[model samples]
Target: MSRYAILLGAFAVAVMVAGGPSFSQEPGQKGPLVVIVNISNPINQLSAEELEKIYLGKRGFWEWGKPIKMVDLVEEDMNENKSARAIFSAMYMDKSLPALKSYWIRAIFSGKGQPPLVFGRREDVVNYVSQNMEAIGYVRMGELGADNVKSIKILMDNKP
Candidate 1:
């Protein structure tokens, strides 16, 4: 009985110490969305400006001379976590999704740029990024696993 009590106390202490970083979380409890990129991409980090340029086609090529590829989920097919899309639009694009769509349409018609390669689902985007070296995109925190893709710490306004 005494040995069991001691083991239980130690287990409780361990749990209390480790609760800060959960190994996994359900959808609602998960952390913020993260910008994901291929494992071989040279970029280890990103800022809002760099992300904007790459996705907007203002930045055509990576530093290593590889063309930058932006993968995307279509607007209507966004995740159930609506706030994640909202945060992305608010951060990367000043305009709402509809306005951004219009902007892309104009860009395409003018031959100024092309919209990102679109996928129908988040997992498809993740799988594509995992397979392509120059690809970049955003995914919800809950979906980030030990895939071939990785997250670039997005520092906005010098804040992580």
Candidate 2:
């Protein structure tokens, strides 16, 4: 699938068909997030575009040929998925949700650009990331040190 097709699908699916990112704020917080990887993974950071590529299944393998395992929050009425959607929208895909979905529907049926494995809760994402060296996911900033996962700095706008 085309790179544009993949991106259009990512942010678009979560946005348009699902009513878009959740606008509600976490109580007394702005829903800050941090990307996490299993402590065993050697890489320490990722460009925003690299993340978008992995999550969109555009980059299928790491430099060492290890598959990049991706994780994500399942869509819901709660803030976790919402906050993720907001951050992903603002920092990554940058496409409207509806457009993202429409692209994916066709892409999937065509056997291209699969999305990440989705967990219903953040704890599940953390658990998955902790156990899999190739895993990558994000959580509320405070959830980082509480688990076996390590935070990976996301280079905002791919800046140095």
Local accuracy of candidate 2 as per-residue lDDT tens digits, 43-92: 89899888877866789887878999988765356554455655565456
lDDT (tens digit, per residue) of candidate 1 on 1-160: 6999999999878976964222233445356678998988778898787787777789988888888888765435334335444456656755566666788899999999988887766788789998999888887777766469888987678423
Q: By lDDT, who's the top model here? A: 2
RMSD of model 1, in Å? Answer: 10.7
Which regions in candidate 2 have their CA more than 4 angstroms from the true location?
1-24, 28-30, 79-81, 145-147
lDDT scores of the candidates, listed in order: 0.73, 0.74
Q: Residue 121 deviation, candidate 2, in Å?
A: 0.9
RMSD of candidates 1 onward, in order? 10.7, 9.7
- Local lDDT at 44 for model 2: 94
lDDT of residue 70 for candidate 2: 86
Cα error, candidate 1, residue 160 (Å): 16
Instruction: List TM-score per model, in order.
Output: 0.72, 0.74
- Give the range where candidate 2 is weakest over 10 consecutive residues by summed lDDT: 21-30
